[model samples]
Target: MLFRQLFDPETSTYTYLVADEGNGEAALIDPVLARVDRDRRLIEELGLTLEYAIETHLHADHVTGGGKLRELTGCQTVIPEKAPATCADRVLQDGEVLQIGEIPVRAIATWGHTDSHMAYLVNRDRVLTGDSLLIRGCGRTDFQSGDAGTLYDSISQRLFALPDETLVYPGHDYRGYTVSTIGEEKRFNPRLARRDRSDFIELMANLNLPHPQRIAEALPANAQCGCLSETP
Candidate 1:
């Protein structure tokens, strides 16, 4: 397997590229629109064919590059089945696995940050947690139909049940941390680690976070799979 993690500074978003080296087929997770070209170039340089562009959820911070990548590479665009965005090529249900070359990417429903949030478990070893679980903190539960209690359960019951050695790759990180293990987060995450459901809920409820600056523009654009206009 081949892997690369790419970051977008403006949104603090992380895009991941995973490929099956034997078949030269690849998939991209949570791609940002502004970095589509760079991502495309890297995919090409790696001599791999793009098979899927997967979104963990509809984002409020930055526009997605899924549609653009699909247009450019004929890659299929995938999103959670419950997400409002209906433009994706595939809408996956919880536990559904999509094959990217030899790799199996399983969609795990982890809704909380948004009504349809999902986390992908890749090849049984690594999980790409889209905003559901961050480095030391979890995603804000103040907007886009977020629920703090549900998020707490999603992490504690579902995600934390994975193997302790499983690697966690989050959708966004503002603190410059790259990766962490399930055991590390389960023991050390300030928000959820070792805390009861009520405690986690209380923490999220009192966060008083500001609304995402790009929500107004990003939501609409993302709903259409990042095609803001037909002029392009």
Candidate 2:
């Protein structure tokens, strides 16, 4: 297995490249439109064939590169089931596994950051927690039909149930963090530490965070897999 974490500094987004080294087949998760060329170059340099461009949800912060990647590499575009990405080549349901050569990317429904979202558990070890669970904080549940209480449940009941040693790779990180263990986040995440669901809900409700600068442009574009021409 080969794994590389790529970042988009502008949006603090993390795009991941996962592949089966033996077969040289790869998948790019949560790619950003602006960074597509860079990602493509890396894939080519590594002698890998791009097999899929996957998204965890329809993002409100940055546009996806799925559509362009499909055009450039002929790789399929995959989004979580019910994400409103009509252009997606496939929609992954919870517990469904998509194979990238010999590697298995299992979808774990972790909604609430967005009404439809998924965290991919790669090869049963690391979990690509796309805004579901962060290092010491979690995503804001203030828009895109986000529900604080539901997010609390998903993190506590679903994510926390995984092995403590499991690696947690978040979708975005503003604080320079690169990775964390499930146990570390479970014990230290200020957002979820000892708060009950209700408390967590209240905390999230009062965050008063401003909306993402690109929401107006990103939402519609992301829904179409980031084909700006089709964005409205």
Q: What TM-score would candidate 2 get against the native?
A: 0.98
Clash count of each predicted structure: 0, 0
Supply the global lDDT for candidate 1: 0.93
lDDT of each residue in 1-232, candidate 2, tens digit only: 9999999999999999999999999999999999999999999999999999999899999999999999999999999988977999899999999999889999999989999999999999999999999889898899999999889989999999999999999999999999999999989999999889989998998999999999999999998899885436
Overall local distance difference test of candidate 2: 0.94
Count clashing pairs, candidate 1: 0
Tens digit of per-residue lDDT, candidate 1, span 65-88: 999999999999999978998899
Would you estimate the TM-scores of all the predictions? 0.97, 0.98
RMSD (Cα, Å) of candidate 1?
1.4
Q: What's the residue-level lDDT of 222 in candidate 1?
A: 93
